[model samples]
Target: MTKPAYIAITQHTKNSKPALVYVPTRKHAGLTALDLCAYSSVEGGVAPFLLGSEDEMDAFTRGVQDETLKNTLKCGVGYLHQGLSELDQELVTNLFLSGRIQVCVASSTMCWGRLLPVHLVVVMGTQYYDGRENARKDYRIADLLQMMGHANRPLQDNSGKCVILCHAPRKEYYKRFLYEAFPVESNLHHFLHDRMNAEVVAGVVENKQDAVDYLTWTFMYRRLTKNPNYYNLQGVSHRHLSDHLSELVETVLNDQVWADFR
Candidate 1:
């Protein structure tokens, strides 16, 4: 990720256009920014990202709390994440937009939070920890798309650039999906019990029949008929639909029965 990122920074620096780098976590965001600065110096880069003098740079980074981030900024790089204060976020964001900094590294979740646009974008990694599932999981296509969007600056640059660094095994997977418009299967089943419980608490579901009826008006129900294979339906028959909904209601109610035991 740092190799490709350094290359990106080198290429864009010649044109004086800023770039954004996305990492998997807040820690990676800070470290990747620092590494990019290191790569710059090792390769005889005068910190191309730092466009201002030391006094001006110090004024720009007044209230920044993260020491590593401050150092990166001095090298003409900035970092963003949820851990930073709003004041610091706004400061870094302004630095990027005003072209004082040439690069900003951010966490995956920050893709939606900040609206920083650049001539280039490099996704450090595609996987992030899913606390709910207690495992590392691939990023949602929506979030990845949003990250890619940062590269294109409308009416400013003729074109945009993106470099995604993912595992070799998933190369083809990303290549296919990035260009193809595949149908999105319903993920309701992943947390059907929790969803059903919410509805029950809201008085929208009162009985077993009510629960099944609720599923009928869902995206899951729509996809059930279109892609029966995805939801593991044996056949697209009335009996099959009824059986599936019945099983779903049973699972949801059973979970509610044991909700507090664990």
Candidate 2:
């Protein structure tokens, strides 16, 4: 899939608006934003912000010093990655919330936990962990929800802006999982399997698999009661648990934005 050049574009308005662009890397993409504004028809301006060390900011702000590429970077404008002081972080949060900054080119670290509302939170791609024995690594579903929550804020339009998923099918599939997984009352430990994941299915069940089975059946039974045509299945398995849980996801998606929020 083709990754878009820009993660998000901000619309300027009377209200101060801040935009958050989530990129996989800090240095390369942050600087690229500065370069894109030079040639592209895209409006507003792009500024780069770095999150690591302070010494790197000088060369970064100056752009590539090579004589060949110097002229191309002359028009570049954006924040550089000076280490974020606590006050600096607070200030960025405020600027973002107030919409003062037109475009913020930030590392995913900028989103470590800050919940600044924006038009869109575009996740371009992610790092993969490859070990010698096995090569499999991915972001946890809860982590993705936490990232997406930055956009699910109280909106000026009253109608919320759409959370768009582009290019990546894996990301889209996770998005659907998150939408279904949102409303349920579960903590980080529960979602991650660190804590016991239990549901009061029917009378009572104490074993983990039994609890999972009961809970899964209970959720599906509730959905079938509401709309019999939603889905049909003969049995369940660890492999297809997500497919079965999807019906509950549909109910949760429209039932409320978040039970906690309400």
Off by over 4 Å in 2: 1-17, 39-83, 128-136, 162-172, 178-262
lDDT of model number 2: 0.43
With a 3 Å backbone cut-off (N, CA, C), the pairs that clash in candidate 2 are 16-99, 17-99, 18-99, 47-78, 48-79, 50-81
Clashes of each: 2, 6
Cα distance off (Å), candidate 1, residue 121: 0.9
Expressed as tens digits, the lDDT of each residue in 1-262 for candidate 2 is 1124343332322243334455545454445555445433244343332222334334433434332222222332232233444544454455445543444445555566565665555554554334664764555555555556665556454433423444465766766775665444223212422122223233354543444454454444445434433345434444454555554443433343354378
TM-score of 2: 0.44
Assess every candidate by TM-score. Answer: 0.71, 0.44
**Candidate 1 clash pair list:** 49-76, 50-76
Cα RMSD, model 2: 13.1
Clashes of 2: 6
lDDT of 1 by residue, 14-63 (tens): 66788889999998988898898898778856876787787899987767
Model 1 spans > 4 angstroms off: 184-262
